[model samples]
Target: MSVELNKTLFNSRLKLIKDAWNNASDSEEYGSIADVGAFLVMAGDPAGEDDPIRKGTAFQQIKGGDNPIAIEIIPQAGAKEPSNDAIPRFVQAYISHSRVGSLLKETHTGKLVKEWEALLAAANSRPELVEISPAMSSFMAVKDDEELKIVRTAANLTSTLLANYIATKLETILDKEAKISHEDFSAQIEARLGSGEGDDAKGPDMKVWNKNPKLKDVDWGSTELCYSPIIQSKSTASGYDLKSTAESSPDMIAHSGVFLISTGIRYKGYCANMGRTIIVAPTKEQEEIYTLLLGLQADLITNIKDGAQIRAIYQHALSYIKDKKPTLEKHFVKNVGFGMGLEFRDSAYLLSSKNNRQLKAHMILNLSLGFADLVDDAGKKVGAENATILTEGVKSVKDTLFFEANDEEELKSSKPKKPPVKPLTNGHSASPVKNKTVAGKVLRTKTRSAAQEEVLMTTAAKIREHQIELHAALQAD
Candidate 1:
């Protein structure tokens, strides 16, 4: 499809986002966020095609064993093409509510109403409101399929809603000057927004909520957000973004740390992932590095094209990063970007190694970079990423700016100046990375302690007893 046509389709989808939100927010049962906002397909390993778990999804396999969504077509009784417009052409439809389980809850009844109100107000007040409206959604357009349009629109709109929610929450926190920890911030977000089954909250209210007529026995949906301290210590090499359920707590050395919050929300049936590394009490150098990386990210966004080769674009970014910061040449990570859609990690992936593919119109991708303080690993130095929708032209997804061009340019022009830097450590000199091996080495196995052995034996005994009971029950049946 032509780029213009795709954009028209995207604009149409944007209207649907507002419609879905309005319908769900004001009404009780429709559920906020559409049923399936984005149709994302991830085929299992081709070898596993026969496996029961992987059987029904895909049939055609690519070189890397990734498969396309499976489909079956039968001629409609004497009709040329299927008259049912609901019938999809490319992939079979499957609905999973794991993402939007939270929307079903009564807790968000008030919040959704308020959120929609705020979105409408903010959207209307802004002079550059055209940018976020369905008309200006050129960044990425959905495929030319009606059902797919519904799915993509839902994902895009819900993402915007969550982004606004987080932004609003942060405004409140900042206004109060709350000295909150990452865990607390994430918890508050989950409550203010919604949480999935994975993050089961426990409390007297939760207990009562489960049994309450208006709130009981409801399925709360899923959202992905991770908050953590950016810097722990000199030796603790931790990434700012990680799993939502990870238990690694940041040290309270100075009673403050650079909190990094990353979120991946599965709203309804769509997914939206975003991350932010903020400095509550940042050092001079920390602030400098963050500014530098953000500027670099903006520059990279400007260079992206719809039909560009993903590898070439990635390599160019790597070169740019090296030029900007020559001191820590050895501390750079390999991945520059990756594909994000229905699944957290899917294609069109942005890998230097995978140059065979070119970014397509409406393909959404993430561009991220990581920097470790070679001088002080404990003093956090990292670059975070936000999701960008690939339009026919260049546009980036930033926190406040969103996909709008006016704000994006204003922010870029007023961006902080790059800090002074020392010359390259070894003049970009580096030896080839050697693979480690201990040839002919004998591996030793340690015997389990008596306490461990006893625990295992007792567990085995219980399992055997359960098995006997199950067998007896089966025989009786």
Candidate 2:
């Protein structure tokens, strides 16, 4: 991709999203498409006996593809690196900075504001399309917090929908619910994205796409299982790509009862990412590691705030690994988390090193940690292990955490009371909390009132119903 071509494609896609969003206020097809993500999926070349997957695909989505949304998964193109990768990054950078950059730079005043005004002027050169009475007012309107949120929602929707698609597809194949081969599965997923069945206006769900296909005469036992996983391609920071690949590890998929999914998408120009380790049936050891990872994640999320030290946080995770499980020493990636925004990777990062940078307010951080390969004594990976014994493989958990200016400032001004605690010789605090006893009992009462029980049951039922509806929607597509 050349510089000029890259710019052209980016502008075109950005225009597409913007037109859709602006028109969403009136048109049914656009429907709040503030964010979008496009990616390339390369499967090993079907034409050759053995060739690096020459076949790849790229997909774009708006607002989770509900309604008549703008989404497409172009096949035969975007297979090569540096081709489809640039689209999402450019989308994120342009939208994020365009909308939020002013808010971020309000501290500097004048220069940034003028720059934005000029850009707005260029964007809406013909006042007829978007009336600009006062340039500053128009710019400010574009930067409205609510509008910013819509963009964030759009980006998040893109990622969430993609994740759901992958999970649903995997479940279909693994459970034998759908007799779909690897080659056809990609097309199936792509067609659903393009169906625009997300909105009620588009008609009932699952009606847009062909649900029933003629079963081909083929021997199921002879065919190999095909899977095409999705990954995020670009980030503002160069090192932050979670690249999607055409090929997948059969051993890991077969032996592992769990899979870690992580990816990001951009909407209205901002980028959002999500990651989770989905567990099927698990052994005791696997359960323990999973719990530990969750605990570490909790610690990071609670401690995260403006002015927190990145190096210190990373060191804390490392220290936790040392104290909890020394066997994972080798698999510890230097980074536990990093900044996320306009680009997949931002300027600040979490790592154990001597650095002076402190976290700033409004920074989007991706907190994650996991073991790459935990091989049991048998030398097989745990997730896809051959025997009941432990195995070598990968496991991880990640979540997006943000630092808000208002929350941090409120916490500082409140000056909450704290109990006195002594520091250990190791420079760690042992802040043991005193337990509160009720009715001279060590544990809290377990009995629930009828009203409370009813409320809980109702909530649970609603959640289950929602899950069922979502599953049906995905499967139907």
Candidate 3:
């Protein structure tokens, strides 16, 4: 997308926030039923992280510099006319002049404080500086047409990178004789994005967990680039606590076993998360668990819709897992997913029993579902013990649109297309198969070894079957 188009979209986003503030002012929930509206101040993240409120209203390119950037939205009586083609007239951006070459660059820190104080003093009736963070969250939960387009693009880019570049070349990249180090492999992925393969938007770094049990506690210093890729191959994925520093062990990619790659790219400040587990030489138990998780994920996605209670959806997922695989119930993640947009994880609409928010149309969701601390039938820990799939989707009024590594025909067509299921001679269901083309080129080619090829083929078949099942479920709904 062009910069001009992005500016126009930014205007639309600001307008949404402005309208949200006005709506909150009229409602009794914010204690503004008296028709008195106060100035809403949104502060930027001081650490220059991806702040939802600031980025949602203003340009995505703008960030916290020497000082915290602030945006003040004063509720106007009537719909104000746009002063320019870019920024909405209601938004007053306070950015430092040092942020040169930035969108909406201005130096209004001194004026912002003075105006805020003066407005408070001049009002005959005291108006409360109501916390509008809730309003902002509500406004950002549902994406507009422009934002959705960016998110879709980001999703496609991520799928293409993972399915085409990474998966296709996995055998060669992780060859036992000439295995690439975790850090080097991460760099290659980054280099692909830097070379016009993906957007330049900022978000969480790419995570490459090779699933090696040896380097579980190695903590490399944080002297790498701001978006340096995190490489860990321990029993569990790194940053599971969501507060620890992202560190990668100086370990090479494992020669065989489960390799989990969870990554996403920020396109125009919108994030798209895609995680896949690649089992080099899988065991029967490994294949069964992966297929089971995929089916479970498909069921969860099918149940998501607009107007559904967030907690209800989560509970449904929990019940589905419990009923399908009683053993994996305790291993399921606490939260199924959460709203995603300008910020990587939007806390306003978390898909958890503790949250009371309802799913709204046009809401972008990142569904992270899987079983951790996995074990085999022999009560022994297995490779890829922490099996998880992090995929994104957009919630619609009727059916949700999940971003997947499938052909365009599968994605665009609503009709349920029967997959070619070749039954085994033993009268059992066909084996799992990986996706043929993820966003474009063939995912698995003849380059892989025969055993590896069979595994991927089975993986692709299972993906297809689940997709067909998902379509059938949607049709039934």
What is the Cα-based TM-score of model 3?
Answer: 0.58
RMSD of each: 26.2, 20.9, 14.0
Say which candidate scores most in lDDT.
Answer: 3
lDDT tens digits, residue span 105-142, model 1:
11222433453334445442322111121111111222
Q: Once model 3 is optimally superposed onto the true structure by TM-score, how far is the C-alpha of residue 242 displaced, in angstroms?
A: 8.4
TM-score of every model versus the real structure: 0.41, 0.40, 0.58
In candidate 2 the C-alpha lDDT for residue 471 amounts to 14
Say which prediction, candidate 1 or candidate 3, comes out ahead on TM-score.
3
After superposing candidate 2, which stretches have Cα over 4 Å from the reference?
1-151, 158-164, 177-192, 195-256, 347-355, 381-477
Candidate 3 local lDDT, 1-477, one digit each (tens): 222334465567667645654675454322332232333333333324432335334333322111332354344343476334223232223121111111122222343445454544554443233334444456557766655655655555555555556654554554323556666777777665433325754432234322222213322221112244444443233322121134444576664445556566665556666555555434555545555555556566656766678888888988987887788787777787677766666666777888877776677776666665566556855324333432222111001111122344654567734333221111123333332333322233232343243334433344334323322111100
Computed on alpha carbons, the lDDT of every model, listed in order, comes to 0.36, 0.36, 0.47
Candidate 1 off by > 4 Å = 1-181, 194-255, 377-477
Total clashes in model 3, counting residue pairs 3 or more apart in sequence or in different chains: 11
Q: Candidate 2 residues 129-237, lDDT tens each? A: 2211111111111222332343344333433344356554554444443444333444444344333435632321233212233112212222111123332111111
